[model samples]
Target: MPLPAMPIETDLLLAHLNGQRQHVLGILDGLDEDALRRPVLPSGWSCLGLVRHLTEDVERFWFRCVMGGEPTAIVALSQGTEAWQVDPDVPAAVVLDRYRQEIDRANAVLAGTPLDAPPAWWPPDQLGDWRLASAREVILHVITETACHAGHLDAVRELIDGRTWLVITT
Candidate 1:
């Protein structure tokens, strides 16, 4: 179990980050196999695909990209496009569980690290500038990105089953 919460900005940011993550995953709560696989748009990204994408995204961005250093292994290998592609063999349940697990791992990283630590790896452009990103910067970026994806998940969930879970409910 998580220790007692800190009454500070880090806690607030993490709360919002985890909330957005949970919000996106919650969209698939009652969905069946076929329903989860149903495409929200003609482009062919199903609801399951979005969850899987977020799984990789959160893990890759927060844990790997920020915590491990910039341009982590996933980025070196796939350059961020891999998350958008869904594996046909993997089941939706596994994808959902993975997202949940990723979130837990991310929270642990956030909890153990300080917000003021500078990134281990800085982009070439930010090397000498005043824009070096601290752990706090990465955390905020993840929160914002997750929230944006949650909006996408909202539209996809509605298109799939007409349930507007992002705004009206969990």
Candidate 2:
């Protein structure tokens, strides 16, 4: 299915968001399963765990639950599962696939909805007084969050194998 057309600003935002998402994935490329699952920093978050967090918390929570008011997403958010923990039995491929799936779903929400549209649902109890009035605001917030995490992933990847996202060449 094709995504619906979006305004230019929305398109730009989505483009930036997608870039960061790819940056995150690119940082983890070529890592073995053990390296992906192994925590390299004091924060105790592995590359795979960060991908899971982006899938469940950032992509699913903001796009599905907040923008689309998806019932399953609402239930999942209400349960308050920690998104940063990947079960030992879960394969690395599964974690990566889920992130891709969530990105597709999130894009669907962004495509069909107008930037000015208010969120379909908001969890007052979950967020307390905080609020985002429109889809544009939500997109901006997600872009910032995803980009920040991509930077973190870059650092983690560096720690793992001295790989960096970018290298300045003269």
In terms of TM-score, the best-performing candidate is 2
TM-score of 2: 0.93
Error of 2 at 102 (Å): 0.5
lDDT of 2 by residue, 123-150 (tens): 7687778999999999999999999999
Candidate 2 steric clashes: 0
Give the residue spans of candidate 1 off by over 4 A: 1-7, 70-81, 122-132, 166-170
Q: After superposition, how far is residue 117 of candidate 1 from its true place, in Å?
A: 1.2
lDDT of all predictions: 0.71, 0.87
- In candidate 2, the residue pairs with backbone N, CA or C atoms under 3 Å apart (3 or more residues apart, or in different chains) clash, namely none
Backbone clash count for every predicted candidate, in the order shown? 0, 0
Q: What is the lDDT of residue 37 in candidate 2?
A: 96
Top-scoring candidate (lDDT): 2
List TM-scores for all candidates, in order.
Answer: 0.79, 0.93
